[model samples]
Target chain A: MLLKIPLAWLQLARQKIRFIVALAGIAFVVILMFMQLGFQDALYESATQVHQKLKGDLFIISSQYKSLTSQQSFPRSRLYQVLGFEGVESVSPLYVQFSKFKNPQNGEKNPIYVLGIDPAFPAFDIPEVTQNLDVLKFPNRVLFDQASRPEFGPVVENFHHNEPVSVEIFPYNGTVGYQVNVGGLFTLGPSFGVDGNLIVNYATILRIFQDRTPEKIDIGLVTLQPGTDVKRMQAALTEILPNDVKVFTRRDYINFEKDYWSVRTPIGFVFSLMVFMGFVVGVVVVYQILYSNISNHLMEYATLKAMGFKNKYLLDVVFQQALLLAVLGYIPGLIISYGLYDVASNATQLPVIMSPNKLLAVLISATLMCFTSGFFSIGKLRSADPADIF
Target chain B: MNEKTIVHIKNLNHYFGGKSLRSQVLSDINLEIKAGEVIIMTGPSGSGKSTLLTLIGGLRSVQEGSLKVLGWELYGASDEKLVQVRRHIGFIFQSHNLLEFLTARQNVQMALELHNEPDRIAKVKAEEMLHAVKLGNRINYYPSDLSGGQKQRVAIARALVSQPKLVLADEPTAALDSKSGRDVVDLMQQLAKEQGCAILMVTHDNRILDVADRTIYMEDGRLFKEVVL
Candidate 1:
């Protein structure tokens, strides 16, 4: 039976236009589900890129901080408190702020995220940023995000041509508040909130924002010695630090960002809801198709029933039809979604890579969706009575 | 149960709908059909002729009395039991319900699928059966491409391909013209004799009464008279 195609396939394929229409409808729902799931995945992936790249075993952030996208500053003294603990290897402070960038082309100020770190070691694992760490030691020099939206001017093109491209920053609210030199290009892309990124030295943070005090910092990246348990270090920091700051390991911090977006943000909830709606749409469309198909062939089915074919045989045929539609429709849906993912990633500058887990999940979801429809349409098959065929 | 008897029935009753609004469709039907016997049940429309045929064919459950086919009692029988009983009986419908999606040969081949024969053997048997009905050249034509008489021949081929002991036909030639109808019944008579299967057919076509070994008349759901032609 597995090797031979069932008569259901022949019956469905006999009507070319109707079969194509059904396939198109199923594929439409599949694509809807893929895009929604893709956007939700992209939201989590891009939002947690910084946490994944940061070199740290533990992190300290302000208790009021909801996510990395909305960073708040805590007193720098809290970072020193963790250093007093035994087995604490090193602690480095990271400064973050949503500063405005003066697009050198048209002199328009657009919001760009800025990261300020000490010049001693790499704060991020990005290759371009790590290789060009020496230049950050010079004041007013910053690394430009090459994947930034085009509104940030041609800093990438200018740097490749060996031209000196300069960018002005508006730290709080002033025209040309600080002039930062774009010495090199890096790629951090963007998150759901902020577009474009600029990396600078800790000293440049104070120079750009003169009103800020040096006693506070946005994040404290902490490391532990070899073979030290991270849980013990986390417990020690929690007991020693004040209520104004919170401590988390690298994994927890990444998960916190994901949770904040997935549960707390409306866009995340909307994407998830859209995926569910796509499932509903698929079930409805497929149920109508299978039900109508059964209706059209009611007499034939009754005749089969009259010939001693059991309910299982009829069900197998409908289920086989569902499986075929799931596989066939899913292929085109996934192909189209791949194109949409590229277009969306380029348009939003978010890291929207299609992971294997997401693809497998959608495939399983498609199968289940069609299966549910098949089950629902079996009620119509009940109407096929051998008694009525007489 | 007699070994030579293919179908035996006594005081059979049938109903329609739930108990509160029940209506009797067949009442106290008593019939016995033997091997290679051709019994034509002639009656007006709504005289329970089709209902009785379906009951004997196990298309419907017996509400009362004893009905046995192939030595298996059908009173309070499970659906599984009824399905097994149906395997030994072939049915021909009024509309010649050949699946339009299948060719004439495939339509006949569908009967052999249930017998668990090899695919090649089923094809061979199906082609042989279609050729027996003089449809050799139209073996690959779908029912929609077939004419009225051609479709009925294909239906007959499908029903007899399995060599069922009892063939129950419900107005098998109702949709054909006079000449085609006569030709269809004559063909059925010839095939039933060759296969040695008892046939219980319900029809109002008086032109083909001579084909039956005996003819019974029904009025208002009762077997009123019997005549041997």
Candidate 2:
């Protein structure tokens, strides 16, 4: 049970500058992987914030919907049909589109995503959106997302400070721009695909999109009774609904968006490829360090072998050195990546978060990278013949 | 003296390449070493004294001969058995070969790690051996920080720290000055006597001949004569 002095650690520490350089290289690779993974996470997480936060157990979307960014509308009568199913609590119709907003003060134009919902039904968990339902029910009143990117003008600041705020909404034409008032502030954040957003009543949105009717809806939010099985309800709705519409639980709806971003989009592939490149670069750098260390001490290793040290013991020392490099390097990588995530979030307004699962994943990968490098370097040990030392 | 045989070699013919007699490095070698004794093999370059020394140390496989070290028949012996014998033997080389990264004490402690000694005891014994080799003040000094003579002393400490039953020195004093060389050989002799361990040295340095219990002359891969000093 007694512990031996770790010669591997001592050997690495002997060349302090070399050890520092090795750790620095590893840290750089870890940070690269963190940034790549962070971008990948943002692509999925930020794109599906609405789907994940909707105060409903199940949802219905147009089967023509390609992604959250690419949306289509189905008949609102289809949502009402779900009410006939057992265990159904309520159904809320939501309409979504992207339009340009003309700043009242400067006349600068900014593209913003718009969500319109029935004022009678609370479909989102956002308190600001629910509390000001009366304001959205009135014509030409919309709640601006405070967390939306700053280029959307001072609507949120003006709404909070009691200043005059007005925006001209363009439902595809400049002449048909409907001037509207900022009613309140909500907290839905922006994704890579879109920046800035506002929530309004379904009637208000109908007024802006003059060609669109109230019968067409984007998302059909369905609340279930307590302890109801969502899968059974989803199956019932799928059977009842026509092929033009699709029924999904909230989880599946979120996953749908995730799959779209991760599979159908090139952003996911680019980020994953960069992460893989970083792993390869890290392994090579660590391999060079361990290989050089072994080369320099070939004779010493042979001497140890002559002293009755098993090859396993010699290999253990090298592996221990690798683990030390991994752990020592990972600390700085994790610390620096956290700071980078914050910087990225502030600069881009995307939800670049450090999830526990991703952190665990990167840690395991970093260790494996170093361990594999250790394996590659031990080929030098085979040449450590004690007879050659003479 | 106990006079128990620690090394026995008979007709130990070894070839360097291709199993042919043309590549034979050592030819018809016959030798024996006893407990707590010093045996120095002196010969010219290419006379095969070093090869015979390596064979006796269980370092080379004995081809077409009978060879035994520490009761293990090393002629066609398994690497594991050779390794078991190596653990009981200490080796000193011409270059000292101290690990440049570790301090003198750490280098010596590395030897005990093979034997699975606890860290605390390894450190204590390593320090004790360094002090015995007159390197007490240099225990914390890295090999790069030590003088050539001091590095060799550290090597000696590493070799003797485990109380190995046999010490093999191959031109150990070749890299030192005359004064340092004499001092190194004197230290090896004193430690081998104090520890009651056998010493097998392959050297061409005639100045240190007085320290050996017996000097054997090898010529053309064969023992030519023996001289008691």
Candidate 3:
């Protein structure tokens, strides 16, 4: 009943400039938290985009495989072994390698991830990739990623205008180069580890990497019969497969890639540290605001104590101010962070976007951060002595 | 202690500082204030009159005596007990100590708010008390906009709004001019008498001596003289 006066809000609103400055400081920290968390989420999401797009219930990779960015090839004969298991519908070999792509316009070279698949089977669920399978079947012809970083060249632009886009490709450490034409465009974007992506037929990939033998492959896509137990099938294949290779359900494969980026990389650690720094900065800023506010009004508080109001009532006032700052500052911070996410997504061509979970996470952290500050500043309010007023 | 007595203090002793540096602020103080009584305490600075006033109002611990207000003992009392006693007594200070952000009526309403009265009733009582103090026209004005006399009047309205059993005032008119000081004391005496609550005020202004039914003096932490006006 005592607090129904909205005393906290009235006190804050009384000083317009100081109130705005406090909210702005808090909003700035909120933006910093959002960007760091956004980058971290984008790192995980972008890394697993290709894995999610591949059309298969189960996958096989070499035991030495660290991530998609790494080149780990297993014997193709091992992939053929999965067909012998019951309920197995079909299997296709996928070759992954990073090769040098020479921009057609400036001849600038950058490493591009190349996916080599047999055109006879639809290896990807992407509509653009599956519809352009015939183009990839032709030798030395590839489908370029429309979402790939623009540094790779204007392949998407030229291909859209029905103009010829031909570029040269070289093996990771090879001297000679092979020419390939961009026949179509798809939408698999770039990640932190890989700059651009290309899809080509299996034969063209072997020709580009002359040292690679037909018996070796990077990934084996295994489609199962409809309504079959994918978990049981995975267990059966994993038991029989040689120790040289490993089997994973599609979900586990995505997690494997995400784990490499989120848990095993220093970039992930840095993002987490930056977020914590934002929280510390937020606490200090809010503490200064609340502490100074308490200090400035020490006399009135002492008078209130003399009027029979308890410390509990005064503490409630300070904590209420903290929660108000948390919620009020969060609005502008979230709005501005969404704008920044668009800028970063466009500039980097990574999957940087806002999600409901991220929104809730930032809000909860902001509240906790402000509460921690309130907890620190109440020491001053509790010391206000009624006898001092006399 | 008589049933009509509002405050009873016997052998009250108070000290400041640690053992080696200890100095007595109040010594062997005995006093009694009855219902509807107006008692004024006059003393020089550092004579412990303010300290004694704070103890009677439960603003400070009783330290070494049997001190009772509204039938509640304050010696060795918990913080909670002090607060409960404080709620029954209204306090007015020299500086007017009004919250700068709150309007005059709201400042007066703060006293009644402690009783958990409904907002509608508190607002009415606060406005009526402000009118009684002749501040009806300035009910919506914040402390910054009011003059010194008006602010002190608002403090009096706040002190009497709760219908407290006793009122403690410390130099309530110290900051006002002659005319304003006279007006402030007149309003406080009139309101406290109408509410039937005893008044204990600590001040040095001799001009308002006739307003008190009895006047006492403190010298060197002891009650030195008394005069029944």
Candidate 4:
């Protein structure tokens, strides 16, 4: 029934300026960790936006396929082969290429990703694209991504107001521009490599790029009958498909694209390294604060020892202070990170969101970081002899 | 040793520094104190008076010879044994060493807290002890707000709150004026008599020497003379 005093809290509260400065230092590193983790996740999310939105159970890509941003094409005949499987329902050939999009208002051109599919079949699960498939059937008509960067002109705003927005599209290295009408709008946001997206008919891609052949395609989407085993079909397809193409389940397809950016690219490596550096910096900051605080109160601690209190009791006090700092410092850091997510997302047109998992992840990391510091700084208190201090 | 002897020491020795630079701080020290006895130890600086007090209070491990407090031998004692001995003894230093963040009542309660007394009982005992020291009105004041004499009184309340068997004080009034110094020792003597506990005070102040039942003087790490009042 003995009432234990919160010695850790009282010690920290006694020095208002020092406590505030310590919290500020911890918050700075927490903010650094949150932002690095945020952007790293956003990179994977944005890069796989199209892959996640595709309405298919299985997919086929060229064996040389590295990522969606890369232009890897295989023979269209490989896509037609998927239809012969027993669980197969239908297959659609998707042509993806980076093309120049000329802003009609300013006549400036920027690189845009173009996904060309047959208008007869649903190539994407997006409501805007599925609902407006008939519009793409018309020659020189394409659906522009509503989430595309503002640099793609005011296509969505003008189109929503019943005004026609026409922009010219050209092959990556072509000189002449092909006039295309912005038929509708969808929500595939930009990635690091491509700033805008366009959904067009398969024949339009061939017409726009004269060098493109009918037999070549970038990706092949395969839908299965209900209750069909996708894994079985994927295995059977991989067994029969020529070595020029690779088969993948939709889940693996998305992960494959994510792995390309997270493992094979320098941006992902840099973000991870930055997060580790933030952790090290946080440990150092907390260590310095706790070390100096213990040093200042060495006499009181020795007095406690002389009063028959065990070293365990004093250690408990120090660890309690560490936990307090972790939780208190994490709150402000999370709030600021939320604000920054909005700013970064709006500015870059990428998906930078705060998930519950990320929040929990950072909390655990902050607690661990502080505990590491607390463990290191207690050596002085442990060796403090009441005899010497008196 | 008599059953009433609270602290008994014989041929005790202590040293400082590592093996290469070892220096003896106390040698051939012999002392004894009975229950309810007030003993004063005075000597020139560096005469090892404080060192002997520290050894008797279990602040430092006994390096050689037999030292016993409340019937527990301390020579080559384990840390746990030293800690056990320490809990039964009260220590008062020259400085009050009050936790600045805590009030006077809480600081006094820290001693009783070591015995795991219930919060309500500890509070009652701490307040009663403070009242005995005539600081009832300032129980809620922090150490920083108290005067030097008042701080020393608070330290007295803290050391005696548990009614420990032996009280060890090292230069308890070194920073106080003559009047306050006399008042502090008088307060300690009154409280120790009331609790029937022995007091071993190490001091250089001669004004308060009359309060001790016997005075012991030391020079060159040896107990040279004993004067019974």
Which one wins on TM-score? 1
Q: Which stretches of candidate 2 lie over 4 Å from their true place?
A: A1-3, A173-175, B1-3, B19-22, B116-120
Measured against the true two-chain complex, the DockQ scores of the candidates, in the order shown, are: 0.61, 0.64, 0.74, 0.59
Model 3, B40-151: lDDT tens digits are 9998899998899899889988789899899999999998999999999989999999999889988998888799899999999999999999999999999999999999
Top lDDT model = 3
Candidate 3 CAPRI-style tier: medium
Clashing pairs in 2: none
Residue B128's lDDT within candidate 1 is: 94
Model 1 lDDT per residue over B151-191, tens place: 99999999999999889999888899998898888888899
Which 10 successive residues of model 3 chain B have the least lDDT summed? B105-114
- Please give, for residues A1-390, the per-residue lDDT of candidate 1 as tens digits: 231325778878888888888889888988898788888888888888889889889999999999887878999999888888889899999998888998888988889998998989798988888899998999899998888888887778888999888888997576556888898888888878878888999889888888777788999999889889999889888888899998999888999999899889898889988999999999998888789889888998898888887778888999988989888889988899899889988888877777798789899999999999999999999889998878
Which runs of model 1 end up more than 4 angstroms from their true locations?
A1-5, B17-20
Give residue B220's lDDT in candidate 3 (0 to 100).
94
Predicted candidate 4 versus true structure: per-residue lDDT over A283-336, tens digit per residue: 999999899888877887898899898898889888989999999999999999
Tens digits of per-residue lDDT for model 3, A174-258: 8788998999889889999989999999898999998888899999999999999999999999889889999999899999998
Q: Order the candidates by DockQ, highest first.
A: 3, 2, 1, 4
Residues A277-387, candidate 2, lDDT per residue (tens digit)? 999999999999999989988988888777788788888888988999999999999999999999999899898899998899899999999999998999888888888
